[model samples]
Target: MMIHRLGTMLLLIGIGALPAQSQVAPLAPSDITNIPPDPALKNWSVRTVQIPMRDGVKLNTIVILPRGIKNAPIIFARTPYGAEKALTGAPSNDFRLALPTSYADLAAAGYIVVVQDVRGRYGSEGDYIINRPLVGPLNDTKVDHSTDAYDSIDWMVKNIAETNGKVGTIGVSYGGLTTLYSIVNPHPALRAAVPINPLVDGWMGDDWFHNGAYRQSFLDWVYRMSADKSSKYALQFDRQDVYESWLKAGSVSDMAKQLGVDTMPMFRKLVDHPAYDEFWQLQALDKRLGKEPLKVPTLHVHSLWDQEDIYGAPAAYAAMEPKDRGNDENYMIIGPWRHGQGMVADGSKLGAITFNGNSASWYRQKVLIPFFDRNLKGSADPGIAPVTAFETGANEWRRYDRWPMSCASGCPSRSKPIYLSSGGGLGWTSPTGAGGFSEYVSDPARPVTYRQRPILGTYNPLTTWGQWLVDDQRFAEARPDVVTFVSEVLTDEVRLAGQPIAKFFASTSGTDSDWVVKLIDVYPAEYAEAPEMGGYELAISMDILRGRYRESFSKPAPIPANQVLPYEIKLPNVSHRFLKGHRIMVQIQSSWFPLYDRNPQKFVPNIFTAQKSDYQKATQRIWTSARYPSRIELPVMP
Candidate 1:
């Protein structure tokens, strides 16, 4: 039977021969699709059930089984996003629905596809918590995502009609979080898992916070989640200008008040615990996984330019991969795409950079399919490497036995600092004479925008904000508050892999400040194949550090005014090759604008409580002398 038989019902209702259900609205004409379901819904069976959890909460689940297949290996996905969206192609009110990339492919191969809303989400019972903490020592009373997944799989193997008991879990982003959780203490039926761009640590890096700097874009998320919306999609502001609205709010505390904090318990918890207290520590995946070996063959997917969750994939792999070192059970794929771009078929070009071919399609057909076929179906191994990564500038895929690839071919095993010099030069040699430092005044009132003007909602796909990573940095060029240092055109191709560390010997005139270091690749001025590529300042890797959290995240202390301090900012790992004639550039600024909340300059107990008076202009200096040689350490590949 058709899941939605609205066509005939609509015809009958139009002629007044039948009555419509009060709660059910007919499908919109625009939603009618000639695109048939994979394996054809006509040849499959759809079942929606509330699977009982250990704690008695029933998770809303949808199971699609191919009609003629018996004992089909199950491909399961759990998300906070509604299961109905994943089932019938219904629209979700939640954040953009999890990418439905290779779902059809799996279903077409006679796999039983399962999608579920985790406990406390839509159509489920229990109090919803973001990044639910693990319940150490599993018991009947203790219920977490891991236990829930174990229970769900146990119940499915016995209750479902399918004979083949093998199961695999895969998800992207938050869904990826659940996928990761399932692997910690997995069920016997769980054979494989793929977590793409998962948010690994709550305190250090990911969507919520970077270093100690809180990501301001998530305020939009908090607002939407607080409301009684159908799904956790981004809240649409009444006003067209979100940037101006945030500017007027003054502080995060004030913004909460404007959003009616009484209704938002999560927002309250977020600001109340500004530091990395027990709240965030309990949620860090790395700390929870602590030396525990992975339970299954895992495939980790990542993108170097991922706007969010840039630190999760690599961090999680490093934490759990040691257990599988001898067996080659843990694998990773790093691509030159944006957040979750590896899921879809559009990895050809992002902003001005092009990958030359459909990378996502290739990954789906060759990498993903082969992995699942071998692991879940007892087929021969595809001979995948431990790490398959795409080098950006060189734009080629390379396989390695280990990540942070061992320097077998004379590639530098360690990083060496390239010193910053006066006259806007960057080189391996340190500066000698006077004028050895660069100075700029950072004013919170006139903070720099992270992207070009008219910055729209990030969750919405129609906006230009998604391509900010690959955007040319010339937009901020010549700004009084922004400082730029460049290296001479490379004589030969300079390839860099692994982490880029920014070491700054600097002093701020104020008590508190924020330091943003962006490692950039400058296209030659004469290059003009693409207008956006001409003199493009593509950011390869960047990081921001709030000076107050320099020592410890839990105990933040202000710097002594005008006292120089050594700050080491570890940027996310990257794989890129700066071709000959391309200049290596470094851009230093105090604010990343709406991307990160502006630092008040003056020290406050809590930044959320900081008043407008706390915001001040501060003169920031980057010293490049022999005594204080400020530099960035690049992991060069020979």
Candidate 2:
């Protein structure tokens, strides 16, 4: 059972979180008998070392090289999955590991690769604190993996031989985040870097919540896995039969029984800290990394379909690269796959669709390799475009000087912010004068979580976790329970980039209620596009919130029953371009199932303390008037 839990969590992290090949074995020095180097690899060596951190933790790492060598100049990838394991993979992420042949091949070309386990986890010594640790009000220690990262690289440069006194780093997801954090200290010897789909912040608002609402499923699965490290609930956890039973039973609302029995303490802690308050502010890379100017050339990689840590990658790109510096140097890529899945596809996998039929080889040969080569090998710039996005249906790469419409750089006509009228229409003519208001009754009994399974075998599990993929507002629209305001079909193209903020000037009948802002690209009434790969039409969507944890993330306050509360939540950013004849849809509802924990409508010390009887069905109001305008503020191409 414990193995099942670990296995389940492993699935969440899986190939998506870790790099690939086969999981490497931890062996003693006697086992270091060198295997003959593949002909392709002539210059590097495989060496093992213990990197000592300030806190007396000796982290383990492996240096992979081209031949029998000393410091061939290092490119590091630090992971929580263990140093040797960093380069390996689970059965699924198998192919991503550079084969002995590929390594030999790259080595023949020349570049040393080093991998390490972070401060804890795997063979490392310190306690693994999951992510960039929290030095919040509860615990005020101005220390984290950031400091440890700095210290280790500081040590590696001086001691390692082949290193001409410099290092470059790269990785996808977790490793990618490590790369960004490692470079922030800007080791004197560090040259260049790349971070793909990195987890941006620990703020419940970002990683685990979409607008004050708790994002479940993926978070639930991950937390449970992290808690036990073994699978006590493996059978019931993975079995679809048991899934329904658990679903019928309850979601995390009954965490003690339905799923995570041991994770409540931490879960409550996360729920308690809902906003980007001091707790999240401290752990977030945004705050920490910003304090220092990013001087290195970085390639921000993201998957268009990426569901995990999707919010962070793009934001980091916008951040590290100075907007003032307009150059091809700070590049970005968004592919057709999710969670970096398509990045290493041979095709047979990826739900029911086989990416193998249509794989992007350029990623391996032209992009990633060339990147490591250019930086570590000190080769000239490869002339790759600044922005390369894979157009889904086209399954082809499109290059641009910047994200969104390149030509619209200085265009003024396209920049416009449409408003959501109370009655459900969009634009200036949507009627704001006479009685601009609407209501919805939120019932906690039928709380909406994600419709798909939590782990694999589920569709769009990361971002769509806890929420159903086919969240057609049609059902909610029919229910007097959901308030949806949509824009008219655009006559021309309008591209929105950067984060979009939704300002809700309204009130709620309940002491605590959640307002979910979902930005969706609504298909035409009679239009339907065939599924690009999974036979499911792509529904590009992202959301954010307003809830009980309004002004204070750490502290909680009720809505005062019938009083109005002005709320605003910065929805996830979108690089979407609304073309001719398409309508922009904004869905505001108080409920999203299992993907988010059900919000108990009554005001109590904590929702956790509320009884089932306290779960009341409360009314919500949307006041759309000139005085209290509730609208989405989008960043135009400019």
Best by TM-score: 1
C-alpha TM-scores of all predictions: 0.89, 0.75
* Model 1 C-alpha lDDT per residue in residues 506-531, reported as the tens digit of each score: 89999999999999999998786666
Worst 10 residues of 1 by lDDT: 90-99
**Which residue segments of model 1 deviate by more than 4 Å?**
1-41, 88-99, 136-141, 232-238, 261-263, 407-412, 432-435, 459-461
lDDT of 2 at 410: 39
Shift of residue 378 alpha carbon in model 1, Å: 1.1
lDDT per residue (tens digit) for residues 147-265 in model 2: 66677778878877766666777766777778777766577767777787777764543456554556654444455335643322331344543344434554454554455543445
Reference-based lDDT, residue 245, model 1: 67
Instruction: Tally clashing residue pairs in candidate 2.
Output: 39
